[model samples]
Target: MNNFTTFFVSGWHHIVDINAYDHLLFVMTLCAAFKLKEWKQILVIITAFTVGHSITLVISSLGYIPDNPKIIDLLIPFTIMITAISNIRNYGKEGVFSNKNVKYVIALIFGLIHGLAFASNFKVMMFNDNIIKPLFAFNLGIEVGQLFIVAIFTLMLFAYSKILKGEHLKWNIFVSGAGFGIAATIFIGALS
Candidate 1:
């Protein structure tokens, strides 16, 4: 019970951690083009990501694949950059976000890559040989954290639309651009 609680909290803290904001940036980029009314789509995407993330996390945790922290680290930022570029390219145009299946598939695939990014640290936190309970609790915590992030962005989008009267297209471009820049920098840094 205690270990479960610890793992849950660890997952939550890791996702929401300001020190490592890559995941947060990815979620923000995903929500950049969306508004509050489109929450069902957002939730489905987030859940799809979690499912993919959980699969890789479990596989990596069980020692099925050897960990390559460097490659995974590079891949994580690359995912964010790709998503940001997609958001930037499609914001004003009728584009990929409108296609539900593609959106979820992209999120799920990116989640798999992001799960590998988390694998090394999660491995360090592994308490024992058996990881089922810890993995479940940790993934649940991440899911909740992801929902919280989506909610914040949704409200922010609402506020921008209502209070600021800023167009979502501009917001999407701005936010996605920032995400792209950050991810590019991180990706470059990882390379060196």
Candidate 2:
């Protein structure tokens, strides 16, 4: 019985697993949304996403609404494509908060949708013991996973910035387009 419980508990770890498609898409979208520089901007965007996801995740998990995992699964990819589009449009812009707040706002909104996707899994986990603690822990794990991926991406971009010097924008477009394409594929696949 104890082993079974431990196995079940371990499964919650996947909720935040960065390698997971949903979580990866969310992080990619957020990272691609804003031009990278300075930890403050990253913090603002990440915080907004976290707050948004946490709100909906907690609400849906608490039975505020019966969340449909399939719907959210599809929407998650759409959110990624939207964010990638936004990023592609805003490439090479300056000022993190000057009018870019709209993008972050969208991030927050999409974050909520992404949270709904998570709520499905969390709701199942709720059947176990100490629901609140596990839920909070899982959310924290997600944040950790997001931050880790963002940091790696940032570092990679910084390195490329130093290398290419000026061609980064072109690369950004290519990468963002790739992300959008991948997202679109996922969304379509989910729908079909």
Candidate 3:
């Protein structure tokens, strides 16, 4: 099967391919750290992340930095791992995050790193003056895919927390982070 077929065969696969395990892991880690259920908090964090990533993606595509696909691929997962680490260290037994601003800053940084990762996906595409149209379309596809995953997760959590009464936030962070770190390291090694 083609890569695209493999990607779209399942919602889970699609989410993983377009968004990457590391990006999802980092988002999961953030959700765990903050345990935020309110729409306002989600909106702010999502906006910050989207803005930060879009800026870097556009800049990288516009030739602001030397495009190194393998390097970016490595850094994408590393960024997620680091974000998880930061989340762990930022707040200690104080009940959730210590400061919202700190989370925002870290999210912005990770988002930029993720932008580079996203740009790396476009490295093989032929670039010309008309490249921007297709690039934007690809990015929009990614965003739509990401949003679908987020909405599903949110809905699942809403139901579970309210009806089934199951919450595994902290464990989710730990597991996702550790798994992402290992996966990224292996992927990077393979690329090298």
Candidate 4:
């Protein structure tokens, strides 16, 4: 494969990998609160996350951010736990997160944490001579992977909405609860 394709595929698979699914779980929880109709808001939230991680990825790649695998591993699952709990708390009370600003801020902050997680591996793969192309391509691949995940999640929500009829909140709560459990497990593992 070509260089661009190699980098893109590597980045894409990095996020979507089934064995290492912290990223997937985080994205699922992040987008779980919104319905298909709220695509614009979802896009913004996802973009904010992308921007957060992209900034850190660049900084970390340049060696500006210190490596702390233990802290980052803990934070990765911690962020997921936070997002999942937030969704659970806001289950029926959609008004709580009516302010998009709060969501954006959360996404950005959590995205930074996630970026640090990404940076550990990213630093290993980066080339010193040509950082820009690979970095941009990698980030782009991540965005595309995120969009793909959102699309699948949106379809599942749509199906649930259609079949269950007004049970979207329950579905969100259930999924978020599961995510929280998974994240908690990972967090405990990290502590050990």
Give the total clashing residue pairs for model 2: 0
User: How many angstroms is residue 117 displaced in model 2 relative to the true structure, after the best TM-score fit?
Assistant: 1.4
> Local error of candidate 3 at 189, Å?
3.8
Off by over 4 Å in 2: 1-19, 92-98, 127-132
Badly placed stretches (over 4 Å) of model 4 are: 92-98
> lDDT per residue, candidate 4, 1-81, as tens digits?
766777788778877889769999999999888877789999899989988988898888888999889998899999999
lDDT of each: 0.85, 0.68, 0.59, 0.86
lDDT of 1 at 38: 76
Clash-forming residue pairs, model 3: none
Provide the TM-score for each candidate, comma-separated: 0.92, 0.80, 0.67, 0.93
> Which candidate wins on lDDT?
4
**How many collisions between residues are there in candidate 1?**
0
Residue-wise lDDT of candidate 3 within 1-192, one digit each (tens)?
443333233323323564466667656555555443455565566556656776776676677867776777777667666666665665444534456766677677767777776565454453455555554555455556556656766776666666777664554455556756765685668476
Q: lDDT score, residue 4, model 4?
A: 77
CA RMSD for every model?
1.7, 3.8, 5.5, 1.7
**Cα lDDT for residue 159, model 3?**
64
Q: Distance from true position, residue 189, model 4, in Å?
A: 1.0
Compared with the true structure, what per-residue lDDT tens digits does model 2 show for residues 25-126?
Answer: 567656754455556777778768877877886787667978676887788888888778777776666655335577568768877887786677667756
- Of models 1 and 2, which has the larger TM-score? 1
